[model samples]
Target chain A: MGKDQILVRVRDLHKVFHRGSERIDVLQGLNLEVPRGDFLAFMGPSGSGKTTLLNLIAGLDRPTQGAIDVDGQRIDQMSEADLARWRARHTGFVFQLYNLLPVLTAERNVELPLLLTPLSRAERKRHVQTALSVVGLADRAQHYPRQLSGGQEQRVAIARAIVADPTLLLCDEPTGDLDRKSEDEILDLLQALHREYGKTVLMVTHDPHAAARAQRILYLNKGTLSAEPIE
Target chain B: MRFWPLLWSSLWRKKVRTTFTLLSILVAFLLYGYLAAVNKGFSLGINTGADRLFLRHKVSLSILLPESYLGRIGATPGVVDVVHATWFAGIYQEPKNIFPQLPVDPERYLRLYPEFLLPEDQKQAWFADRTGAVAGRTLVEKFGWRIGDRIPLVSPWRKQDGTSTWEFTLRGIYDGAAEATDTRQFLFHYDYFEEARMFGKGMVGWYIIRIHDPKRAAEMAQRLDSNFANSFHETKTMTEKALVQGFARQIGDIGTIIGAILTAVFFTILLVAGNTMMQSVRERTAELAVLKTIGFSNHLVLTLVLTESLLLAGLGGVVGLGLAYWAIERGDPTGGVLPVFFFPPNDIVLGGVIMVALGLATGILPALQAMRLRVVDAIRRA
Candidate 1:
């Protein structure tokens, strides 16, 4: 069925900035698409526009020119407020650094986005508990971000992202700041979630092993994108 | 997510800075409360008064008005009644124990000012007995003066030939029924003072006039002045509040001055709070940038930072207002010279407004700064 339709489409997206009156282009006419339930990794060198492209798709920044459609909503045409509401309802993001609020308990961090929804406190807590359990850190739900190990913290971040039950999960170098064991554990969790939950996953990573988990891979080089199948 | 916990915990992250900012806010609000109270006190019952007016010499208060002017003013249209008064400028035997004296016509005075609760019999006794004097409850308590005790008052306006010369019998103790009226004054019959043949005789300092209708006060005042306008002595008519304000007026434009002080204080607080918020947002730049990348908008990041600023300023305002309430409520039992020493409900409301203003002012720049940050750049900041 046409690969069950496209979940996200980026067409002729371009991003430029001025550095002291000089035009500096980060992404030039880059086009990409992700099918439903696809696990894709974007790989590139520094300044290859990998992160830039991810940001554009995430609607975190406005491109000088282009159109991005996620689930039939032309996000590039949406107001900042509409985009925020859409992100709140539909996207889960994990970062290289665990960006959990340090003052909140792990459970509270996971419960953040759920607050924006109509879920009751009891339901939110239930979801938080289940997500933390899925992360194998149910015992650590009461701990602050500072009290958790790097891997534990990232696991908490992952739990927070998924607790909202979003359609898509975006991870940027999720294993880049971890030790080998932590990296392996994260990769295992990501693979399990992709296999069992059927969540569409997109990851930006330098770790070949991390990318190996993806169903497909995309290479971004100096403001351009190329699709490639995983080995 | 609910913004309140996010706002609250944001401040908890910088404990020292938050505490200091709160202290600064507390001090600023405390000052604001005191200044507002002073402005209120200075104009208290006078500005809105219903039953009183002062009849003083047009030229100056220090200059005396002829006692004869009382008859004409009392007879003026819409004039309910009138009484004569002069600042006796009397001294209690000791320099430290000072009390103001007014040589008043007891009969007309008691009839005019019902705010002073004194028995009609005692007032009559004071009038009949030439040496009799009446003291307010505050003066009686402060100096331990008893009724029927013979006390000597040294006159500042007209000193006796002898050092310890002036003498009078204390006949009645009076209490002011309202805050606007002074409870520290000593009143003796003008007849008694005239009997002593004291200086400034036949010439009273001012007149207290009560009118039939308060609404016609301005009109009656004009009539009273016009009656004496071309006469040998010119008179000025004003409400008792204006008279009281006149006394407080020697200190200059208190309202304008107080406004300037409050502005300066609020501006200083704004700068202080702004700097604090700026630093807070700068420190959290990476975190906020991350929030943005996760689909939190620039507006949301701005809102978070602004909410933190508001929380800080609001908490500070509440703290400061509480302190002011305690200080003023715990002050002098006898109504300290600054009698209207109250952190009024309006002042609390004003503090609330200030807190809101400060919060908005302090938050805007930090919020804008956070909003303008490049997500990629912030994540890479060392």
Candidate 2:
């Protein structure tokens, strides 16, 4: 694979869930590709399997019968242990609710993923400082999630997601719980991460405005992915 | 950044719940310490010197042995010296007031038991007057007895008529060399008892023999018993440790009782702790999913939960045992019912082990549940 080539390759992926004796098919023969350093957003209705597709790409869930290749690794076929290591090294995640550990301070929360790495204490401290500075939460490093406002908490969550310098950053409705002003700030941060740091981004959201901030937008309709023209 | 700080804060997140849980664990370990001391007191004979042997009547401890057999026992090949004593079972003030009132050959008894530390003046006073007695320091303090104070003694076995009643002047108060040694015994001259008693004049309760070599105790015991074999009153000779252990066993199986009580206590504690851990993990379901999404492996999550549980239980255990040690040092909260209570170092070690085991047992299920959580579902629920 060459530079600026396809970084994620999904071919005919299907995901089905079984509730007792009833089978619910979430995804049906989906195919998609994301170029290196591209910021792609997914918009879909409820139960349309946009989150399922993102989870599969992030190595958090397995596909029923298909192939998912991220960073040149067939993550769908990886064991649970190997997949976890893979996720740690290559993937960062931002949740809609900002998913910051309530007991930890903002800096400590950002340093969570770095614990999986072999970095020294000084190195980890530097990385945490950098991540917090990038998100404009350097002064709020000592504040816990409960101590910060909604937008500040999301910034800390974003800092935590990017602290380890993961190859891909997956956001699940990153602005779902934020006001318009906070959403604009978070969208600007995501744009800066993609343009300045050359980070690949995949986000699943229901808001068209959140999708419009991405370089490319895909709509999931009737279990099939289709590009929506950005005007 | 480190697992330690994360675990510490997680446990303290709900201060009230954690404090109460810790208090329960503290109570459990405190009970463990005191119960362990009581068990140690009941099973009190394993620490005796092997050179000593106690020879008693084979039929029963209450049965009398012939005093003439003492000479033969002393003449045995391995015998160093033979001392004889008889229980007077005397009561003072009321029937509830009880103490060891044994009459012994004072010189021989004191020589055999060097652990009973007595002053030279007290020894001479007892030997000087046949009607004088030596009491332990604890007994003297407990009853406020002073030197030259005549103590009236009554025996239930013997009718305490005017002539049959006994009185002795307290001449000395003895201390114990070691904590396990009993310092509450009342030792008087056997010559006085033999002369004053109406019946069983030449009979003694038991004979204590000191051997030159402790390893030769079994051989000497066999030789002494064989000498009294088929005689008027046969003898059963055993090491002093074994004899004390037998007496302890006759009361009840203290070790088994302690084990059962501790088992019940720990089982209830396990349920309480396990329920708390389960609730904690359950409430943090969404947070755990966030951890997994951020690349925390399943094993790390499980270990984090377990470590939190261990920290909670271990903190409580140390505090509780520290309190127990303090109480033991303060001495007999029950006011002398348990005379030989002590908190041995080994009991502290055992309590620590129980704390760790309880932590593991209570945390394993909840930790596994945390490990098996599906990140997608947890995030969805949140």
Candidate 3:
């Protein structure tokens, strides 16, 4: 509980989903902690609740019953409005589909999160340029999502995530839609962002190859977390 | 970087659908503008000052009053001058070619209507020759009539030797001196008309009186009507505005009809535009979810949806209003109902208000749906 020792903590987390008369528990009494600057990956079967735990930790979904402490704040108790503000200031997300806006070019897409900030126009532009450069997509800043290759689009999404310099990076199946070469390129970019910026990363994926790149890998089976990382 | 570029790009993402929706909106607003002008024209008369009063037979305008009423009306204390006219009901060539033709005492009538500017020489010529007539500039231009040309009018009221045709030599063309003055009349000598008519002799259709003070118009109208009350031919005296409004009312309930038509039109537009907005929002569910994840508040997402729909409507509304204005400026192409029509500033303002309201109405439900969408659910659906 010392300052800077831990970035995210969870205790007895439970998530339930209901369909008509049937109730399904996605996560049950989950307990874990992610220290600052650690890159953790969650891998499980499709219905093993790996993604649900990731969403809960990222404050993207509310847990049915549990405590989610991220950056010393109990996000489980935060209001939707407050959660959005907290997410803006503390978390960045990357999804399997790259999820970049099709209409905007790479630079403007990277500038999206900065728009929510109080940064001046010049400062925002410089930050956007730096983020794009870090992802090695500087020359393709003006290219739209459709104009970029799969790897390039994922790189743009990564640039968008880190543009506002959030402390926590939550990625969901980042390489789920890419080929082997593209997946390797994205994995490399994520590793560089984590090592250079000291970002705390939690990624959910079905690919063990993608998981092996993380500093520590955890397994979720039947809504429960495990210490073992299987190749 | 600004909100506008996002809004603009989102609105035009489906260019074909947006363009068609905008065209429909444009057409609706165009109808709104032009119909407003037409409605105004139908309900409004020449904006005469309060000094003018029209006296017609109480039973109906077609019922004529005795010629002796002229002198009595002029003798009234507040009345400065009185001029009487009889409807000629003349058809120029075809039966469909109909316009207002009246026979009046030229000298007196000209004095009463200072807005009709006629040349002194032409006035003298029209007065000297009983067969000569004066036409407005609009009438002359419409029929391509010139001075010294004999214009034949087929009269339904009178016939001479089995033919109902009467011919008059066009002597002069007068123009309107003021904004409200109508430049579409055909006037000739009342003396010649009275002497030649086979029946209804010595009777005039209506009397036009000019008073000294506008404040006394209602009092004068009441007093004048009372003077002819209980007589063989009772009189109804009213100001020129009331008289014109009465005539327009006799045609139909213009306000209600226009209101009903506009309501139907706008309601149809609302449904069509609302459906488009809903479809647009539904297609962008994942994008909206992405926005929420990126720290866009629920209210901000709602505003973005509303702003995009409003921009679509606003674009169409402006273009529609412009087309309406252009069409009105070129005058009514039909060249029948609306003789001289233009879109008033008030109507333009009204159309703009309708456009904005329509945008809000069409956008609200879809925006609300977008606002209430769960990011997790939205992303899953996408």
Candidate 4:
């Protein structure tokens, strides 16, 4: 793929963690490329470095070695402050637990990322309304997280992730804690975000059903990726 | 300003905890306000007058000074005028009803202390009637003593006929020019007191001397004291402010005592407030990590936490000081002991500064912890 076509390029990546005096290597010699608007999923057992790789790509963790270039900018070498600014402009994140600030209503939760921007209050309100409407939670704008079901809260989280109109959407087990019906709904939302919105999506999930919805699936084993799917 | 709602909401996330913490801070500041007012009252003389000097018996305040020494003091250089007053240890109705009753030459005393605002008619009325007395507005109101009413006081000093009661008609009520001025005194003509007394007829409690230049007051005081240094009654001369401070010091080191109490209170409050912020941050670790994931910088997170703390302290402090001011306005609780009782403006400002300092002291550690939190670890732990 052309350099412009590839949105994320990871080369010779390594990640190490330490617990007291013991050393544990999470990811080693990992290389991957994600094309623009591609829906990619990483599947592996727990402790197989699937989430670690996703974290590195999202600039939430720095690699022990090698480089990460996102949209032609070398993110691995960027300072923490610079990475934060880049993330604000280019990335959105959705977690499995649907991490919504419980004290805030759905509308306010969706407005979180917009607060970082210099958008006028009216403009931010419009953006939040549109993001909530896109997630089909417009009618529940004033409902707090405690007032909503697991599926509804996850929908609110998705609205927050997209409120800022970021370039990359990273999901770590986005539907891991949901019921089967809720899981299908979230996966459908993710697919719509990718196919309809043309978002570059990277997700880490252990569920084969969730993995199958992605355009490409990579199995992480022994700190490397392969085309074969995990059982 | 845009983030105020977020900071406010975070502060009250745990309603019970926040309410208790707020009450704790309120009580502490309220105590601070009362103690600071008391300290100000005790040290009121420091702000009284720089140009006026007081001359008393060098041996002790209880020891009387000869009234004849007033002429010698007035003759000294830098002395503009001199007046004398003798303490009348008198009580009204009951012994518990205590207040300052002084016998002074009405004209001279009124001329020297102009802060005592009395009407001209009342001054003439007092001078015309030999048995006339003028009471401060505060004392007049306390005992419901109206002008033209005859009030009798029981004194330990007896008349030549062995009677312990003295009667005088209330001629006027004097108001204080400033809020902190002691308006609880009762002043009457000294000639009547001298004629009625059985002994020590030519003695006075203290002499108040006005000088030409305030800056040379210490030098003038030394000159005045030397005039009586070798006489039967040696004298000590000092500024009126020093005399008031000396009287207050007899009660103990009020400033140090109040300071020690306030220090203990604030330290305890610091621990309580600090632990509260620490717990609040710890409980919201996952939420803070999510905020970071959404592109909030570490500095922004730190600011949010610190702002939350400041809001808490500021709210409690403003309300506490406000309540204390209201209580002080209601009047002194200690009947007549603390005559000059009111919260000073400077103390209110100091309270505000302490509130900010307390907030910063308690918020810093927790804010730093929030700032240094690694997003992945916090998320995983949560």
**Chain A TM-score of each candidate structure, as shown:** 0.95, 0.96, 0.97, 0.98
Q: Lowest-scoring 10 consecutive residues by lDDT in candidate 4 chain A? A: A222-231
User: lDDT of each structure?
Assistant: 0.81, 0.88, 0.87, 0.91
Give a tens-digit lDDT track for model 3, residues B123-195. Answer: 9999999989999887798899999999999997684355678889999999988534567789998888887
Position B93, candidate 4: lDDT: 95
Candidate 4 versus the native: TM-score?
0.92
- Give model 1's docking category: acceptable
| lDDT tens readout by residue for model 4, B1-382 | 7787688889999999999999999989998998888887888757876789999999988899988988888888889889999889999999889899999999999888889999999989999999999999989988998999999999977989999999999999999998777889999989999999998889999999999999998889898988987888998999988888888889988889999999999999999999999999999999999999889999999999998999889988899898888887787787778768889888999999999999999999999999999999999999
Candidate 4, clashing residue pairs? none
Q: Tens digits of per-residue lDDT for model 4 on A115-202?
A: 9999989999999999999889999999999999999999999999999999899999999999999999889999999999999899
Which residue pairs come into collision in candidate 2?
none
Q: What are the per-residue Cα lDDT tens digits for candidate 3 across A1-231?
A: 576698998999999999999999999999998999999999888889987888888788999999999988999999989988888888899989988888888988898888889998899889999999999999998898999999999999999999998989999999999999999999998999889889888999999899999999999987889987543
Give candidate 3 misplaced runs (Cα > 4 Å): A120-123, A229-231, B46-52, B59-71, B74-204, B209-223, B230-233, B238-242, B249-255, B334-339
Candidate achieving the largest TM-score: 4
Ranking by DockQ: 4, 2, 3, 1
Winner by lDDT: 4
Lowest summed lDDT across 10 adjacent residues in model 1 chain B is found at B332-341
